[model samples]
Target: MSRLRPVVAAAFLGLWFLSLPALAQQEQMPPPTVGVVTLQPQSVPRILTLPGRAVAESEAAIRPRVTGLVTEILYEPGTALEIGAPMFRIDPTTYEANLKSAQAQVTSAQAALTQARTSFSRTERLLGSGTTQAQVDESRAALEQAEAALQSAEAALTLAQSELDWTTVTSPIAGMASVAAVSVGDLVTAGQADPLATVTQLDPIDVDMYEPSARMLALRDDIGDGRLQLNETLQATLTLETGETYAATGELVAPGFTVSTSTGAVDTRFRFDNPRRLILPGMFLRGQIDLGTTEAFLVTQNAATRSKIGQLTAWVVRDGKATQVELTDDGTWQNHWIVTDGLEPGDTLIVDNFAALSEGATVTTVPVTLDENGVVREQPAPEAAAETAPAAE
Candidate 1:
């Protein structure tokens, strides 16, 4: 029994020394450091981002007006061209020959009319002396017939000239020319089903956007009730598919004349300066339009989380303990959640290190400050550290 007592004492001392490290570790373990931001009511512009497409202000199909062999494509594909710029040239040999023939016929008809007029004058002068009335009438009829023939020849010449002009296909509008459908030496017809090329106006391009009619109507109601103040000069900004914003801004042209019955959306058109031609037709884009300013409580998206049930929640620190609060997020605005409810101004919102937090979990908050760009940066929370030390001890 004496030997057992010594051994037990040694084991007890060993256990006590082994537990000291754990006790020290617990004392040194600080409450989980979390980044926190105080909620602030701010006047933020209510901008609506909508999907849209870029469309050309004008488009023209380049088609030949005279049937002939395509001689040449004068303009390069994907090149900007001016109005009346030559796009394609058809074989004008036939048209030129026809024009010459029509001109010769006009000359011949003029000679005949001149001879008929001379005979008519002679017959009229001799009518009082020896010429019969029938002869005079016949001479007058020949002159009238010759005049009609001359007029027909002149009309044919005019038509031939017009057709000759059509042999050189030109762009009716100033725009970028598309690739030639019919290459050089390809046979093309007048007013054919296929066009030789296409031209699309790119500068001052149009962007087509659609908004749900219900939302549009609600906006109008808000404006009427003075709940929302719309910008007098409504401006829009575009974001491309690559997530880069277009440099030039845009203006709202007008809403579509008719609402789509099937889609329940109203089409709206916006005009944007596209001097760089960065935006092409049929490009999918997003447009952010400023709908005016409103007062709202704003919270960073990093502080908010969505549950499996689609309820948005955030951890708010109150009395040095983290509490889960249900947030009514209207939507995201500039990387922040626009909270309409569930939070108030001056509430501390936990941003970082709150992911694994539970309701009423003790926390040491590091207060953060937002810069001019709205980026949150951590600040020293001396008071928070002091408050949490007693609990940790």
Candidate 2:
């Protein structure tokens, strides 16, 4: 019995030693489950978003044409006024008195001129009837002097009339008027540094935006290379400061033909209809311009990560292993990265379980589905999952 016990114990010890290697192997990690998407080039609109400011199409400063006391303000401040509309009324009493004085001088000069002409005619008749030549010459000189005096007087009268007409200040344009600079009873003058008021055209306002010159050149090159196609009518979309899109679209009026020396950017202007007056001059806004359509590869943000040095990278799955790849992204489109390089069509991109993956690590890839909104969702890979499952004893 003692000999049989030793033999059985020896057999049990050998079996336990063999099972240790199998248990150690079982503790090793299996392939990590990962969600992946197949790369497919898509046609997407190339859009450039930039900051801009709304500006009035035309602006004019109102100043008094004559020096006088401001008697009354004719138009309401901040209200729309048409061209030739009265804006202010200066006291016209002084201007009227000046005009009357000028008229009196002109009347006196007319009487003098009539007298001179009569004398000259009588002298000429007397000279023909044997009167002295000296008398005729004196009458002719007197007529000339009188005519010159009348011309001077007429000019003064015209000046006075103009001054009188300028007493009533009018708007030079059709637009909204600013507040009055001078109140009633205040004496204002022509050629003053300060303006009486300001008018600004609001409807069909303009927006000025600046874009980097380098970026614009690059876009043009791409278009020339046939990599991108631009629309015939270049229109832009506006976003207000409150993040709401404006109802009316704007057309690009003046493209940046010249680059700014200081800012290294080009100035572009867009015109938008402002019937509701929602967009005001000097208001800051955002603008999106569609450059054209281009072929690009779209990947979810989760599938890509930024390195510490700001370089973008992603994991591509092939032959049941994940390979790390550096990527160059043009920009973001609908919450996804628009990759320009570092990936090709038919490459499997790891969308989820990226934190647990490394280069050359085996991964169990599941297909990812995207909805119309570009939202990524995981789908069960039944065949792949079943094949990778543990077999029954």
Candidate 3:
């Protein structure tokens, strides 16, 4: 028993001796290294993303003016058309005959007008020579009646010419043509209830963006307090259904003054140039409008944690130690938090290796930067960065 006791004691002593070195190594190890970005006040763009719908700038429904059978369809469906371009031709046979009849009447009226003037001149000459005053009066009355008939005939002729021209239905505006609702040989009436076709102007398209009224009110307050500065020009960019961004930048054409009763939002209209006809009417889209600039710290979302109660907190290196802070952010910008408060300039915002961080713990910070794509990358060394920099002009 004594021999066994001594062996156990010796074993314990050797194990303790072995663990002492490990304990000392752990104590001597340096603090965890974390990548951080130094805080600087930058003019970050304040963008508001909203749902929008594309609308045509102008649209027209084509209807026949002259009541007749549709003889020919002049315009091709889904093609561009200019103002006064022919779209449908009504049967011009009846219209042509009516026009010819009007022409004959006009000629007859002119001939009668010439004869009446000559007769009136002769009556005036013979008024004092073997011509009674009563007879001259009758001649003058006849001339007047003939002149009135000519005027009436000319007015009818004008109407006939107009009706003939109306036989060829032309476009009232320049736009893209839609399919014909009525086919050839179909009888149509003037000012009918149904349209024969449609034309839509789509090059310079309009987008109606709905913005929440509450958010707009918040923006107004922020702007009033000088928390945000408006841009010189209001612009917006669109994201298509396929998640591709549109190439054209839209301008604010109309700002809403009335709120929608059903949506709790206001409709702001934007105009965009779509020469390729990419945007059509009634297409739902996503748009990000450049509201203005606000002086705020942009913190990466990964560095921040939100509490169950919706409180945002992040770890930042302050005085060479990790410090926890409660952040007040307006919203997210580019997948990052637009922190409006609870941070100071020159603070080191720990981005990576922060899960293991604790309050008041010493931290080693490595300067890092976010690229154009919001990707975290270690900052280039001073000499290497200088070498890659563009030369002075």
Candidate 4:
């Protein structure tokens, strides 16, 4: 029995020793797979994004000068109208009768003046032939009174003609118009506060946007140094929230002289040729203005992480080990970072598996591509980037 017990104990010891190897193997296994990126320098755009609103280049409110019931509406919404074209027809019968009465009065005054002139001529001859002076004077006074009456009648006739024309509401300017208020047969009183329609010149429209004052100052410096083009119009495209592109190129108008106190931004104007009038006034649009060449740093966005102190940080790989780097404040990239500090050239940055990573940890390195959402993308090497740069002529 003693010999059997010794053999059993030896077998148990052997099994325990075998299990130790497996435990060590599990501990030595690598961490989970993650994405990574490298730090490098490339040209980045120094663009300032801001909100903007569209407005018409020229607009006129169509209102009536005289009061009457609307007889007809000759214009429709989105219709193009010419200058002096009749848009609304008011009741003109009343105005027409007034004009006719004024004309008759003018005729009656002219006949009285003719009779007075004939009497004056006779009186003048009698005075020269030794007729009574009192009679000649009285005849001269009657002629003068008749002349004043004729002038008053002519003034009245002109006023009546003007009122008749007001019954036909004509467009003051030539352009595309919008139906604001009223339809056919709607009573439209003259001198009423409300407008009948609104006309806008849509071929060339304006967009007003605001940008930070700091960005504007920097842009001005870039322009002066030829790093950016200034006072020159650039082709711009507007993207609506619905992802539609407005089919027009915009020109940069003048920059605003006043800066906003609340936001510290300056209003800037842009002019776009909207020949089709597809863009409506008061619509919001996203504008892209390309200010040529700027000095910027380029690094993968994955490499940038935020520190507990509310600062952006990155895990820069140095000598095959991870190191924490706090990126500078002035940083931006298309999907990367134009870091100001905490990074140098030839540094490899980790883009994935950062939560469990610790300082000085050794990691396997790999190149990573950034997707549109700035997430790490493991991809094969790009042939385009591998091509040698062309020599400067």
> If both were scored by lDDT, which would come out higher, candidate 3 or candidate 4?
3
Q: Candidates 2 and 3: which is better by lDDT?
A: 3
Q: Against the hidden reference, what TM-scores do the models get?
A: 0.68, 0.76, 0.77, 0.65
lDDT of each: 0.87, 0.89, 0.92, 0.78
Query: lDDT tens digits, residues 21-59, model 3?
Result: 999999998999999988876777899989999999999
Q: For model 3, give the RMSD to the true fold.
A: 5.7
Residue 68 of model 4: what lDDT? 84
Where model 4 places Cα greater than 4 Å from the true spot, the runs are 1-38, 93-161, 173-180, 183-189, 200-204, 213-231, 260-264, 275-278, 306-310, 328-334, 338-342, 352-356, 367-393
RMSD of each: 8.4, 7.7, 5.7, 7.4
All candidates in order of TM-score, best leading: 3, 2, 1, 4
Per-residue error at 49 for model 1, in Å? Answer: 1.7
Better of 3 and 4 by TM-score: 3
Decoy 3 TM-score against native: 0.77
- Best-matching candidate per lDDT: 3
Stretches of candidate 3 off by over 4 Å are 1-31, 100-155, 306-311, 319-321, 330-335, 359-362, 379-393
